[model samples]
Target: MSDPMNVLAPEHRRLRIGDAWRDAASGATFAVEDPATGKTIAEVADADVVDGLAALDAASTAMAEWAATPPRKRSELLTATYRALTERSEEVARLITLEMGKPLAEARGEVAYGAEFFRWFAEEAVRVEGRYSIAPSGGYRILTVPKPVGPCVFVTPWNFPLAMGARKIAPALAAGCTTITKPAGQTPLTMLFLARIMEEVGVPPGVVNVVTTKRSGEVVSALLADGRTRKLSFTGSTEVGRVLLRQAADNVLRTSMELGGNAALIVCADADLDVALDGAMVAKMRNIGESCIAANRIYVEEPVREEFSARFAERMGALSMGHGLDDGVNVGALIDEASVTKIDELVADAVDRGARVLVGGERPDGPGHFYPPTVLVDVPDDARMLKAEIFGPVAPIISFTSDDEVMAKANDTEHGLAGYVFTRDLQRALRFAEGLDTGMLGINRGLISDPSAPFGGVKQSGIGKEGSHEGILEYLDLTYVAIDLPGPARCSGRPACAPAPPGRPTLPTPSRSRR
Candidate 1:
């Protein structure tokens, strides 16, 4: 028989009800596995429709009370949660590694970045504001303010479990909205650990409930149907993001979606080849290239294509691929076996269409879902790898003679989430920065996803921004309240407010708004 479930942690913690954790009514359990070793790490409760409904009901019951609490209190609660998370960083990191197979170092980074969301949004809690204006000829005073968007459904993906989960949860809580989180079934341990931490941080139970289940569609449908879930936050593939958007639309719920990306790395003729190669290696190989912002395509100037490809291949070959927890293991297995198959099909199709496989292009014969780091040249624009979001460690490099041509090619795909350009020419770099059809760009660097910077995409990438002040506002509703000082008539829809009084200490008609 296979190894017994090694979940040392409890499988079913009390669902956060009112002020306490309570058992699920369904009493169903499912096992979470370590993808590296094909072993079960934990058996978590499988949240069915019943469990999901209960969570929603709990949040619904607690929404008014939580919303009434002062913003300072909300910020303080998130502050406590962040402190708890930092203090238990090691423990949570271990859980992430155990369940998701991300490296210990990267896992630690996820925890730190996850906590940053809490800290940043904690500070943003008080920034929610309303503007004051004078109504034109209404003679009435209006008061408008920003308020919590009520209950939200947070569905996070398997990759970057803790960070993605924290991205959704911290903001909703900071906005004084109760939430129900659904972590990917394959990796729920880290999220469960976080839920426990939130409880300890004095978050009122039922303020946040996490459920792990294979029946995600059913649970999601139930939450969407319930009028109480006013907003939905999701981070995953574009296809799934679309489905969620449609479902959310059925109930007219607000949404924040961080979807898939087909990011391109354009290496100019004068770029620092050494720096570009090093950064591309990390960008293409980090998280085994499972990241949405990872470099998927490389468009090098014809003058330097040969040298850059050769040097890039050498470095890629030097990478050590093994288990995530293994020391010096730079590349780890993909999240699942099916993803391995998909990567294989894409690479094979590209090769069949005359693309040259420079470094890697196949999955090694192994027990785990491991695909070799792949690099391709002469990749046709029609190749699936070029147009589709290959969520794996495959870089398809195509040569371009002109900057304009490559820019067109890079923006050819429907995805406009993230892109990269490496160049020593300041003028060219500025032009590319202004022209690249993407929401975020990296110049001479591969770093994206900064907590202080807003992250989201345009076109098919999804709607609304996440991160910075824009991210926090996703959980809030803005209302403009116009207050007309107890006075006479003002301008009536004219460019200049009703002609200012005739030199009798006449005041401007409050043309612009004041906070």
Candidate 2:
């Protein structure tokens, strides 16, 4: 079979603004490389400050019409988009592997998972409702309604490129807001392909605009500085999130951040060892550990720590590493050489601080940015790997005696995106599940993210939720309306107006029409 990457050809490689494909005003472009081979696969038009401003202007112009669209009509469009995405799943998955290194199977799974958000939010669009209440004085009624917040800016990351973009864009559009998305430079091709899909699915020109650029700082700054963009949603490192937050403060923009995480996988003594091992492999190594919610720290109860560590090391050692397109390959390359250097540095520091490397640790002898799946034991708390988010294929194990001790260690970090606990005891599971400070917890499960559940973190991890019904609310504004009733009986400060008999008074039914 021919390579899917080579077989597919994208219709447009330039900025998508309004109704057409156009080049950057400055005529700049950037090369997107395949992480597995370090080869420039394609050159994408790099939007400049002028193009960024134009996208924002277009979105702002479209906001009024989109917001006025009926909820059911919005649902119909999203449903059509969901079907379109599902039909082209294979092509999009291949594009993901070509642009960002992840196993082809995993990339395929991401496409299906990403499409689910569109389907889920399509159903959610029509269900968005408000509340009505009778005033205390009985002369008026109060109606609370949800309105689109207005134009939004989505800044997505490279990891899980298709899914992350879909997760943010689908909800924003469903909420009746226009948006301009700025995808990471490393993997903008898949997102650009998605923009084409949106256009093909009958999405209006300015309702969805995608801008790819190497000058991310300049573009992001231009969008944030514009007062018309009412909201900004970002998914990336906490450091960059902070910078975006400062820029967003200029307009007091509404922001939703899905930032960094250092999640802990706790394996109690009573856990099913075999099941625990499977969970560990999936949690720590999925996406080559590039995910923010990937298991970064492992705390095993003392009784099973050694046994678990040995089996884990053996499993890690046996896994195959190669290009994502290759059959039977279990791991892929890091995002770039800088990521490779950071992983190596962290492992070296841990080993120097009395940590023991049980399996692979060094960079592989190869042409691409590949690193062997590494396992470490006795990693000290002071080691950088334990202190920071390790976005690589490295698993560090720590042994603890009791649940109290492990819980303390797990909640020690500033991040609280997601965590995992493995145990057969129901009471103990509930105890830790409630005690953990993270936003989402997995009990005996490695995978916690889904379109039906709310995905976000507390504290410094992030500000708001995504993927659930609440996620749509983040893009909406609540407005209250009061209506005064007319008649001599409804008039205030009139002695002739007496309270109605309490037995059975007919109240007017509220209208269901969209205002």
Candidate 3:
């Protein structure tokens, strides 16, 4: 089927590497299909090891030059890039909607969120700070500074193509580290479009290269194994994250992974019923419930379980599901057949295990991969739908009585990326906020993916942080330099050392080491 909007009228572009666009090795191409229509929207290059090597080399050459450029200059470039993206956001949004099957409104919001990363990180470029210290007595002062960690290889998932790519690429560039990015083949158009926008906005070639490919594992392995890659940023399933971790370990390379999430929402007994019911409907169904941070499991207090369930069911039933391009559609399809199958399997497993179907179940009768917003009640603790991350428009609700019980149940999953707590009682809110084992928590709302906030997870959810000051640090290194004003320099062949003055400590010998 043809694309709904042939906005991408220009000829297909090749992968970006070293300030130039080049075709994939052997001229291999992969078909990119739009999930909403199950149609081949475009064919993108299937980047292989050869392409990966070229990208890495380009990034290596560009890193030092970019790092040495003034921070203000970097900020201005990023700002310009952000403006360009904003100007073309609607076009980008249509591309995302066409490829990912998210409603047009949600697609537009994702584009805006992606652009925000550029804006926020552009400011972060000038905010890096270092520490200054005084010597023990009257020796010399010590200074600490931050430096970019060279080139990084970034791989983002299909669920949130534009935002995820922005999350990694914006920070890497802002920190003065060049990047070679690989966007998921299933939904690469939005990001590819962004790369074009960057070029138009004057982001010099070689500094930020993007490649789209179907062979994720091979490309990722090639990137991680290369010694020149200073850092790796990945967002995907836990299984893939483990493999990347081991590969990065072999080279002793730095890695930041934002993997799977089976987030929990603890609805306390004293929570505001109206607010809880309203937020619950939106939190569990956002992105058609495909978000890694989407509230998958809801643990409601037994006392208010009945009322909560009723309100939740009413609100959920009101959600409209249809094609993303349709003006009245509220939720849309699971990316494709695979996702639809996965959601179906999980829902079936829950039903067979005795979970009550509170509302919409089974696939929506349509040509697309549309699934209705479903809510499962009386879910067994061991059900796959409850135990695993359900990346679909399904919410499985469970009941709990005590605070301790709910917290334990919430923390039971192997993954802990994000958690939500809704309570009017201040003490309970504070306690739950502090006690949730996830990397991030939302006290009353489910909004946790702020650009300024640190985003990541603990346990099997993922490694390292992805946003805010912590994120910049992941792409930077700290170095300490000490200059001795009164102490003599050690001879090239002589044993070193100046004994420190009265109460002063002596300086350690310098060894040339590269991080």
Displacement of residue 240 (Cα, Å) in model 1 is 1.6
- Model 1, 1-515: lDDT tens digits are 22222222453333544555555668777777888877766666777888898888889988999999899999998899889889878777767776777776778888899999899989988878776555666676667788899999999988898889888888888788999999898887777778877877788878988877889999998999888899999898899999999999988999998898999999999999988987788677767788889888889999999999989988887777777777887777778888889899999899899999998876788777788887888888788888777888788899999988988888887888998889999999999988888999999987777777899998888788877888888988877666656777555777575655677576557646764
Would you give me the overall lDDT of model 2? Answer: 0.91
Q: What CA RMSD would you report for each candidate? A: 5.9, 5.7, 8.1
Q: CA lDDT of 438 in candidate 2?
A: 95
Per-residue alpha-carbon lDDT of model 2 for 1-515, expressed as tens digits? 34655533544788999998888898888999999999998988999889999998899888899998998888988998889889988888888988899988889889999999999999999988999978777777889999989999999999989899889988988999999999999999888888888888888889999999999998999999988889999999999999999999999999999999999999999999999999999999889999999999999999999999999999999988999988998898888998998999999999999999999987877688899999999988888998789999999999999889999999999999999999999999999989999999999999888998999998789999999898899999999999896432435646656666688586777788936
Pitting candidate 1 against candidate 2, the one with the higher lDDT is 2
Instruction: Report lDDT (CA) for all predictions.
Output: 0.83, 0.91, 0.84
RMSD of 1: 5.9
Residue-by-residue lDDT tens digits, candidate 3, 358-418: 8888676657788888888999998997777889888888999898888888888899999
Off by over 4 Å in 3: 1-5, 9-12, 486-515
Q: What pairs collide in candidate 1?
A: 14-22, 15-22, 144-481, 491-498
User: Whole-model lDDT, candidate 1?
Assistant: 0.83
TM-score of each: 0.90, 0.93, 0.92
Between candidates 1 and 3, the one scoring higher on lDDT is: 3
